[model samples]
Target: MALTTLFPPESTATPFATFATETAATPFATFALSSTEAAATPSSTIAPYATALNGVNQPMNILFRNAIWWGLGVLAMLILIIRLMQRAIAHSRHTAAMGLSGEAQAYWSKNRYSTWWKFKRHMLYAPLGKKRHNREIRLSSAGNIGTIPSRFHAILLTIFFLSNLAFLAFLDYSRSDRYSVLADLRGRSGVLAIINMIALIIFAGRNNPLIPLLQISFDTYNLMHRWVGRVVVLEVVLHTMAWAIVKHAATGWSGIWHMVGTNPFISWGTVGTVALVLILILSLSPIRHAFYETFLAVHIILAFIAILGTWIHCEVAKLPQLAIIKAVFILWLLERVARMARLGYLNYSLKGKAWTSATVTAMPGGASRVTLHLPRHVNVKPGSHAYIRFAGIKYWESHPFSIAWVEHKPIHEETLPRQEKETPVEKQLREPETTTDISFVIHAQTGMTKTLYEKATQCQPRQLTLNAAFEGPYGGHHSLDSYGHVVLFAGSSGITHQIPFVQHLIQGYNDGTVATRRITLIWIIRESEHLEWVREWMDLVLKMPKRREILQVKLYVTRPKNPRDIISPSSTVQMSAGRPKIGYILREEVKAQMGAMCVTVCGPGGLADNVREVVREVQDVSVVDFIEESFTW
Candidate 1:
């Protein structure tokens, strides 16, 4: 009789007892359900030869797991070292470049040979093929299969995958009984799956320590997260298959079904495996992109069930991998708790419990501007972003938005408590009080954004205030202060990211603090009305000290009401009716390029990709560094 035939399907018999009996009846079953002697062993059954192989395999699993960490640590350190060296090499040049005349600027812009530039050209900056990486590969208009990873990222992933294959293949295959071999295979894959689960959790965290540690962008970490998750799923499938093959060899398909239904451990494992398969299917780019909100909710629920099932599976069997499962559970729990605590402190005031507030105003284009009033001061950096959670609309959802404007409103002494009588002059000499206002320009596209726009338009004056809380000032790890020449490319709402940098650099240029000598902003939009979106802020920027001497603005209107509507505001700020030639602009800029030019793009994938391609091509001709701002979920 098969194991399930021993009792009714609802039998309450202990797993230790049922498993012990199954091992006794079928010798081949020893590969899945351990010998009665091995109730103490974790996920694998122990055959005669397994007794010898188990000792060697368990230690190797730990070694291989540590090896993964060691490799990552080395890679992180290498990147850190490269950044430090670049800073040191540019330090003196930065000071010299800022003071140079126009003729001297041309001399400093000449290409200097560096062997490392090839690696940057081909691997670091290169796309998977000719030129299609950041831009999504679409089947039709709305179908998205997702963008490809960079060549360097692809290489690292391939090496990692091959290493996993090699680790699984590292076993000695001289055993006479093939069951022992399968048993060993089952043990190794199980360990790999559990260890990789921990990596998956780490990569997926919004506060991933690796991002700051390696100076890598969150987008790159997210890319690694998807691949690591796929690896975990693959190892899980292999582990399940090995168990089923051995179980069937012992008592046929009926035995496989019986064992799965009869034992608690087996049942939980089967549930977990099935959940993982479903997750893999739904997480495909088409489904995930099309129905993102539903996908997110279902994805989390299934992942929780999967983790819970496997945790109990290992616990009941007293499996060695149980410790790894516990680690995974604890890691996930800690991140969630940390996020909750941060939100509490950041959102609500401790004294009055007054939360942060938001004012949403419908802008000229299909966009809404959210202005947050905070109770205290926050020093926002250029190139930084925050996660905004708006109440009464997607209350549980927090989306990352670039901080476009930050203003601190100081409380005058006239409004403050008069502890002691002070003259107006003395009061003005005191330090300024610090209440803050931060604003984000959000383009209405889907789900939460679309609803926000609709709601704001319903109210009079096309504006409404709502309860809101924000979570961060994450990112901003990059700085362009050391570059003598800088070019910023923005499309539509992307001007939000570039504005803060523009203001900071201009203020710095007047102060003679930063090395920046020249700055150019290229903004591309569909309609001229979009200019109304940032007109107020751009007006203030235009009037900055020495702005006319150092900054130039180029506005590209892809489609406009009339050609005259695209007229230049001033000599410093010019306008065009059609698209700007990406290659031609870069070539002209390079001719007069100052020492160490840097090109930055924050826009749609197509715009960013085009800018990236031009930057890569001009690298050999001139030293142009490229940085793209991307926040892919």
Candidate 2:
């Protein structure tokens, strides 16, 4: 009675004796405990009946026992049938191979071996390459396609599931006499459960260090970061549920309350649970997440709370490891914050002190270009970008621009006189070791570029006091090493980024530093005039030997001028009338030139999406050969 109340109460309890004795109501009851005992009692009438074999109970028991035998019998038959089918298929293949010519047979055998090696090689190398290709393998820690950071984590999860099953089996075997099943949670394996929980946390916390590596793209990276937090939340919920079930069966509902209050681990668990629930509610499709600015703020707060809870949950003893994790995330956060602060300060200080003049020239088809004048000896790099602040805009955050030109220091010939007293300022005026004219193509997009175009065309000889704070040279666009071919995919306005990359490729090829066999440039855009913005790039690609010898150019125009336009040269200079399909572009157009070929793509949303699609499709492509760069943050 006490045991009954501890579980669910005596009223709900089903007695085995009661079940066995009610034989008139149910036939199964005759074999139940009470009925069988009564039949076995040594009364004259029952003793004779017990010895007799002709009875309904005998038939019923036999039928019940034979049901298990029938099930196992069917399973064996099914397995035998599958084996025969596989053998038959193998026989057909052998029969066909017997008729092949000697040379053909040898070639097929060699090809088969080569195929096996290729498949095996990819499996071995996939993880090493996954580090470089960061985005593809990033999955939610809860249960997304099983990201394996440590081989140990994967093995642990498998062991956890199996061990729990075994424990459940043990519980069932122990209770076979009573026909009672032990609950899943009561049978949970402690070590395996702990291992699974730890692995889940490790995978969730893996991103604490990756922020800095993805610098200047906070908006993009934050999306993934926030979602990872979401996954962490889900994992914690499951962890809590597992504990809930275990506590309930062992000591009833009161035990749930007792376990929750007494456990130190539960304190952290509660914090994590609350934060996750709040975040999930706020992030619902109908709520504040719909507003980008508000969502960003709330997301950051929730992230902090969740991480704080995680830190406590892992226990204060692991602070050193936790600090290392936190350090990586904090360092990157500090860097972005510091840079933004520096830019803001410069914009204010340099506003009146620098009375600089600038020019804005209108290009064909509604695009305009602007150049800012600084005190002349300002250092800049060809590929480096800066945050630009123009006059008359307060609270308009600085926009990113590539350096177009910088003053070059003069070098003296042997015949010329050498000057003394080269002051620190004079030395500072000297050109950078690797210097080139700074340039960037401005696309008329909806944001800052559109504002720039409107203001520049309207103003006359504008006395613009521009303050620029540089943020990069973050990406290594031209760092081509150990590659035989260079392929660049640039969408409309993405040419600014790709042109410098291609130019570097051509220079490297001519200098013999690069052994690139081919340099193919594919540009996707809407207007032909947009090509004029990067005509210098087009001309260079056309003239370069590496480009001409191995380089091929394909231009795709989604919106063409005439109805007769085709993608090939014979028609309107456009490769295709519709948007370029990534699958088609890579397989039919790019794959022949794919081996040891590096693919770099940059552009708008559509272009980035297309490039991502291609990259995903070619999951088997060598990681060294694929590079994706997005110019916009």
In terms of lDDT, model 1 sits at: 0.77
Against the unseen true structure, what C-alpha lDDT does each candidate score? 0.77, 0.44
Model 2 alpha-carbon drift over 4 Å, by segment:
1-224, 235-438, 442-449, 461-465, 536-552, 562-595, 604-624, 630-633
Steric collisions counted per model? 1, 6
Most accurate candidate by lDDT: 1
lDDT of prediction 2: 0.44
lDDT of 1 by residue, 251-338 (tens): 5789678878977877898898888888888988888888877887888788888889889888877666787899888888887788
lDDT of 2 by residue, 269-317 (tens): 5675677678777765334422434554675576567656655654532
How large is the C-alpha RMSD of every model relative to the true structure?
6.2, 17.9
TM-score of each: 0.87, 0.48
For candidate 1, report its TM-score. Answer: 0.87
Clashes of 2: 6
lDDT of 2 at 431: 39
